[model samples]
Target: MSEQTTYEFHVAAQGDVLEQYITARGRNTFIMGPIGSGKTYGSAMRVFDQMCEQAPNSFGVRKSRFVAVRNTYPDLKGTTIKDWCDLYHNEDCQLGKFNQDFPPTHYLDFDLEDGTRVKAELVFLALDRPDAVRKLRGLQVTGFWLNEVKELSKAIVDMCDGRHGRYPSAAEGGPSWHGMIGDTNAPDDDHWYYELAEESHPEGWLFLRQPGGVIEVTVGKGEHAVTKWIANPNAENLANLPDGYYINQVQGKADDWIKINLANQYGTVATGQPIYKGQWNDVLHINNNKLLPIKSHGDLLIGFDFGRTPAAIIGHLTPLGKLRVLREYVSENMGVRSFMDFLVPELKREFPAYSKADMQAFCDPSGWGKSGNDENSPIEIINMEYGITAYATTSNKPENRWEAVRFFLTKKIDNQCAFEMSADCKTLRKGFNGGYQLRRIQVAGDARYTSVADKNKYSHPHDALQYLAQGAQGEVDYERTEQLRQTSEQTAAADSLTGY
Candidate 1:
């Protein structure tokens, strides 16, 4: 409908304000909508149409340059690039692979037919490398299309805008440079992209928000701006998308529904909103991980995420309600007994304040708890050897646990938390380096998120995050946690009650 129709629609008029506002825009503007809702098609049509019109003076050889960016190469190749190549490249207009054929791994370039060619440089970046987006230097970028702006951060937007300054604007008579587009639907309020950009540009920015089939364009968040909001045509303007794209994007996915699908924001569709979208940014630093000593705010607590390979760990707690994290102990092929022994001494050395009395320890209840098949748990053995009282905490409800971690993540604990880099935990860290990304589901469902799952065959990290969150909520009973059975036995008078 709207998608295919836009291709044939002819507006011979030059620089329609709407088209020009879209074409000449040099600032970061998000074009977010449901999966198919003409997002890919709308962007492609506007860019190609106006660009061809501008290339009248070009030589017989078509040459144009644009950057089609995504979180990774496959996303670019399989989605954005493919869409562009299939939709725009016609016979008279050739799509050629010059000497440089950037494998669709992340992003690539293409030479079009008109004297003007289109160069598509795909960049797969994570938020942790805020500077990574800055690397688009030197390349003469005629236009940039960030396919999934929802997964990107404000830092990246800033970098793209900042770097283009080198290109002289029309005022200087040298080819004046302008940005082609910025687009994403709605993301969580806590999302950095929303916080740093949306909050700041409420009225001054061009915002297109869709509550359902209807799309509204707001000049800014100001009262005057809100009055000027316009609804985009849903029939021919947005009809060509597969019927179920919107349904799959905002409702059925296992994650955020209202903001992403209905409101057209970009973010994880987590119903529980488990890890902060920023966790993506944090995990990106996994490659050059350097342990930053945590500043002690509260009694630091550690949670074990046991794996058959390198066992993962997270140590954090509010000693006196002040947040603090010791080091993260991650290792591979280490036995339970050795881990307990090794970690105890290591914890003692790092957090000297956690003396024999003030310590609280928690591990997954599913495996090796005292009542389980395994006789000695890592916690129990650690206590027997170090004389440090360790608490065996049962996990909190799954949804509740994810919420607890979110509370901490949303709070201001400037000096409280710290992440240390370890050779083994690099994979986990990489998972956190990027912001959570939401994709359009083919089934017409709500949003689904892609992030680091368990490195092990059994994706237990999801479970471990639940375990770690239990302690964060301060629900642990230091003494009575694992002692539930022992206390019950001591109090039970089975011999007398049984009429023996």
Candidate 2:
């Protein structure tokens, strides 16, 4: 077939985000939206468009290969694969039948009206399979579509990204364009997607998010108080769905579910019970303006949570006793010494105005425990090496730590939140928003959660915040107490020397 050959093929991508997503030429492109918002359909159409646009090979044939991925075999069959078939298995566009293999594959080769041949391959794989990585390693493809990417990990995405552009080798005229496309409902704030899209935002990666299907509105007053989910006027793909799809789906569903699946808000699925259930109002406790130290208010307090994943929270206690958390340092698999190396420079740069004397540091009392490798405790390392005197928090009790933070969370001065954190403190904010939580006891019929918080990425940063709160709130002034003890001892010695 000739390069001039043309066959009619068209797929209309609805909504602004989906349209942008389809047209995006970034190396990695992702679209996230509420359920039934046509994310899958748009991704499928984009794949088809990409396949058709491939540069014709030596024999006037467009060649391409694409892999579609989901989290599990069932999800691949039930959702990702089914969506592909629904879009492609039609008279207007003819692609070969999808084969039932260990990893499903569809081989397409058809001639166009003007004698151009289109050849493409579609492979579908599930991550849950034991040989998933082995299969991924063996693939060379034009591109990939990460179906329901929220269920997959960064590693899976990276692996898939590496596989693309390898299928249409240099001999086969290479791919006209190569990249990855992904679609998903909203994921939690702590998710890698959120970190990459919202924080890192590296070059050659694009993320487009459709407006939520519904918006929460307050409907009733105090005694008759109620929150309702109403259809959003700008919601996409409504024309293709049943009447009131967004509204109907929210019926009898929890607010969190509706927020995530319909509203397209980033939130956790709540496998665990939230530590600060009702106390943390994201709106109230989180300041939109980047919080900075109020120099005249009080000294900057640094809180530390030490161990494999060390974390630090830098904040200030205002004259009104409001805790204004300004910055956070969270690291994984780093020793206290290494963490200090990074933190000291950051502290100097971030809070240049504050001198060492103007900053007080507190840490988990357990930081005093020596590990096998290091005879020096974390506290000792910070003090002796970093030259920053750090005090161990009075009580390492979980309840005390929790209550110290709760005291600020529940406290209000003239209706203003006593505990306010900068919007940039995403990790800690996510933790307060439910990332750091207590695991739900999995007893049938009875709902219960453990009293102690579950340890995870969020826990370390939160633990640091607890120490800051505990120290700042006057639970015990370890520094002052020590000074007083020394003063008392000195006074007694003076009296003995005077023979009194």
Candidate 3:
């Protein structure tokens, strides 16, 4: 044999499952686990191995193609592509220049130790929009790898499935393998991936869930209490990691973070600091019991927040003084007229028992100003055109509105939360959990937060809720109060003139 260098493959104790994952053929295979569990490395190595296994032509060049997908182009550059390049960039492999044409592709040409040449093309795709699905329509590929499947939707997954097993053509020999491999951290329990892995379990699908490394145990009492993380039986890939890796990682992490990322459990874990913190509990605040249906009872309270993305929360004060958010409406890239059109019909269909007269609308105080081409204010439009009397909140100060919401959440009504939201109101639920959160700043080795909550997709729904709280809590009518004060001063002045 010509002077040759050999590389030996050593399997970690936790890598047995990955070996099994590579051998098992399925229409869809998901390798889900916690951080540093070798999920991405193992998956990428397996795909490379499979591509090398393809039969070579007369020239001894094995040809194959693959599509690696991510949620956005920026993520493709920073994450998936970077990881892939790190894995395959070696002396044996030659990475070709990137093809910047429609549906960009990167070429990898390498030789196995056996002198077999491997020619593989990887197409990096990002499904950032609904139209992005159309880009996958006419592609030919042996297989696909979806990195961080939680960021992707079901429609993108379904579309990718249809594009596999078409490469190398029948003339050069049919594709040796055809399927999809996905890897992700534990996502929300309601995510589509969780539904498929835990609930659906469709035929020809392989779902592998790794056990979490950290287990939290409560110790002591109240403020003096301590929480400890004990190594659990589910800790995999420890042999591949540095000593005390998981231990160091779990320090200063929230309970949800420990559970979702370290424990590898399916639950709603906020990526950032939760706005409501101790006030909102998924089990307590969001459940079948809390998301109860409501019929038209007393006067319906509709809180409206207007903007590029307008939102409305329809609620009613229960007999026990609790505010029950029965339904909600949100729209994007819509005008006031279009939103009203959608909202009016939806209200009619859902709350047929209640009419315009029975509804009292409370809007953002800023809606009092004229916006865009509208000659009248948003409140005026609702009252004049929609025939529903709408009033602006007493104050637009975020602090006051947020305090009202906090009061409502903490208060108990018959041993339950005074404020209850329907599960169907997903946007509002996300906001209360953490999507609407204060901005964190690091100062002198300590973390500090701004008083104002960050304005984002969650802000609109939360603003609607805030307006509702301000309305329900009976804020002082600032406009009317100011008017009365002015009138009183004018009358006193007139009386003084008469006395003079």
Candidate 4:
């Protein structure tokens, strides 16, 4: 009789959730946890298990295909691809070079027990841009694994589902197991993943969340101190980490960073002093009372900021003497013509009640220079081509325009803000919440602060808004203007009758 040989290896569960995660059955499975929680390792192990589960055909080959995806090419190469290679270090697998052919493919040809052959082609993809969805088209995959899914949009997740469970060909008896698996750290509450996991809880979807680690630090006399890292009860993979790993990581970090990276909480963190500190509050500024519909009669006041990254804001003067910003449009790497193309359609769609004749535009005074393409100023393009007469702000000084916006942000009437932006205006909301902030300059051999807000992503939208605020600050209220006009007309009629 021939001697038999058995090869045995152990796969230890890193945490309470890892074992359950490896065997969980679902159309879509998500493993979410804090840093160093082994979410990626658990997800990759599941993918390997599914590849091995492919039943052999008549030719004795277990054929399968999977795609390991990330938000960008650099992340794919640097993170997911490395984690995948590490997962199968002991297996008799050969990893092929990343082929640059159309629909790029990476291969991992290996063998299983009982002389069963496995050919698992692993394709790596990056879905970074809006147009990146095109790459997922026409792909037939047994399943897919998305790493750091917080960086990806929900559209990419939906597209992956549509492409999965169709690989290895039906003629080859189809896949034994096929579905999508993903791993992520805590993302913002507004992200779609939060909705899927926290709100929707769709059928055939399994979400496993690991608890965050806690660190407490105490200082003693003479600069001595004691610190403790308490692993959350639900945290996993503690055996793999060094002593005090979680505690050391959070030392001297900001509260927001600690909350996100260590506590695994979802909240906003400001890198510096928020420009609209004490002026804007999410609960107060974004209430329904502040976001009411616009009245139909007043001119649609528009503020324009001109540059390679052009932006515009459309607002109207409320009867209560406040500025209600209704719509905002922003784009980068576009000229005035393209910007107008985007803005004009949006304006017509959002404010169908208002016509071009009822629109009044205000632009940055600096745009009056003949430095643009075709030697025509932005003001010239707006008036001549678009047929909407535009005027530049009276002052181009940054502080003057900033003060104009600050007046609206700070000076309230009857305990209400004088200015409010629609909640749908995300870019502008970011601006009010520290996106438009002063650049912190570190002085040599001293600790002093500078109050100069640097121009950045938030600058253009805020600049656009400043034009509206500064221009409208000196504007006559439509209701007041109409009342004065009527009073003058009535007096003129009485005078005419007396003269006759």
User: Candidate 2 at residue 387, lDDT?
Assistant: 64
lDDT of 2 by residue, 1-500 (tens): 32332456666878888899998877999998999999999999898888777888878888999989898889889988888888886565556656878789877777666566778988998875434688777678889999999999888887777778886899887888998999999898878998887667778989788888987654543336355678988999888999898988888997678878998877975578667755676655767566789788868899999988999999999887888889889999998888999999899998888887787788887777889978778877776567676788889888889889988987888898899888788888788877789998988996798989999888999999999998888664477435534665688899999998
Per TM-score, the best of the predicted structures is 2
Candidate 1 ranges beyond 4 A from true positions: 1-26, 53-64, 90-100, 103-128, 131-135, 165-172, 202-204, 214-238, 242-255, 262-500
TM-score of 2: 0.61
Q: Please, what's the RMSD in Å of model 3?
A: 12.8
Best by lDDT: 2
lDDT digits (tens) for residues 35-63 of candidate 3: 88778776777777777788887677789
Minimal lDDT window, size 10, model 4: 216-225
TM-score of each: 0.39, 0.61, 0.50, 0.50
Ranked by lDDT, top first: 2, 3, 4, 1
Model 1: per-residue lDDT, tens digit, 9-52?
34331223224334545444455454445566556665564344
**Rank ordering of all candidates by TM-score, starting from the highest:** 2, 3, 4, 1
Query: What overall lDDT goes with each candidate model?
Result: 0.45, 0.82, 0.75, 0.72
Model 2: which residue pairs collide?
1-115, 2-115
Question: What is the C-alpha RMSD, rounded to one decimal, of candidate 1?
Answer: 16.0
Off by over 4 Å in 4: 1-9, 89-105, 215-229, 268-500
